[model samples]
Target: MLANPALQAFSMFLVGTALTLGDVHSHVWARACWCLTDVLFLMAFVQWLRWPGSYGRKLESIWYLRWGGRVSLRKAAEIVYSEARAQESVWAHAAERMSLDKSPDGILCYIAEVIKQDTTIYGKRPPSTHVEKLDPLQLKYGTVTNGAREVRMRDNAKTVFTDLQVDAKELRRALHEVRESLRTTMPI
Candidate 1:
């Protein structure tokens, strides 16, 4: 029960609801127990929701640093990958606790797939040495070409050209692909 928060919550909720709805209403002790159980279930649910073994937070942090000019895409990717690899055990434990259908190793392989996809996206930046240098003024204030916004050059002279809008459907498709791959790879 300690290992399975959802099950603990569900069992508590079931017993609490039964006590509240059934003939146990006349007993004050039963009502108090029910309230306690319900509160425990809520706490367990919140704890489960706040589980820190999430890749999304890591990705968001990388994106934030990149957008804020604190790190380049390549550097962000390296950090993200290193963090993901370091947290593999946490992720595996999370998978074991959260899922009964898929094995922990299967969840790890899913994480690997996401890491590969993200690496491809963030690793495609042009090498710093190959970046074409612009005028100092142009470097200070990047120009927009064909409506695409160009980000300022880093100290290493690498610039990022962004379209300012990402397709929501494409992002959803990538996430769905990761989930679908996990489902498909799991044993029946």
Candidate 2:
């Protein structure tokens, strides 16, 4: 976080300008340095929230903001999607899907205990990722957080998250499906 040169320079410059813009002699030079440090720390924490962090961290942050009661579910998903697109490695790739026992959002997923809620998704039970091939399950139901605010993008009409979900029922079924269809494979 401290390695961001642009952020460091900007925070320093802003603090310096503010101090100098007023009566310079009113504040000690050493005090100004401390002020700059404080500003830098504050900016760093605030800016850190914008970074596309590790998958779980990023998911939790977005989920936190989304369910923070500040915006609607669709609006939250849209906000996260837009911010993710601006980052280098985008949030959730739309092309591929993985099927196994459970989604990455398992029992202990939420960042804060306070955020653990049964309102939208059950946090206590390990969610079932399995489903019939009729339609893609909402990622939220599976405790995942990439697709829509609902987890697996349930209503593509609501959010832009488009993570594909293939129903890999069993090993033999998966093998047969793989041979039958040439699907793009993604890393686990």
TM-score of each: 0.29, 0.26
- The digit string of per-residue lDDT tens for model 2 on 55-144 reads 676666455453443332333333333342333121322211222223433211221111212123221111444322222234333333
| Clash-forming residue pairs, model 2 | 138-152, 139-151, 139-152, 140-150, 140-151, 140-152
Stretches off by above 4 angstroms in model 1 are 45-50, 53-188
Candidate 1 clash pair list? none
Model 2, position 139: C-alpha lDDT score: 36
Lowest lDDT sum, 10 consecutive residues, model 1, at 116-125
- Name model 2 segments beyond 4 Å from true: 3-68, 88-90, 95-188
Model 1, position 34, has a per-residue lDDT of: 64
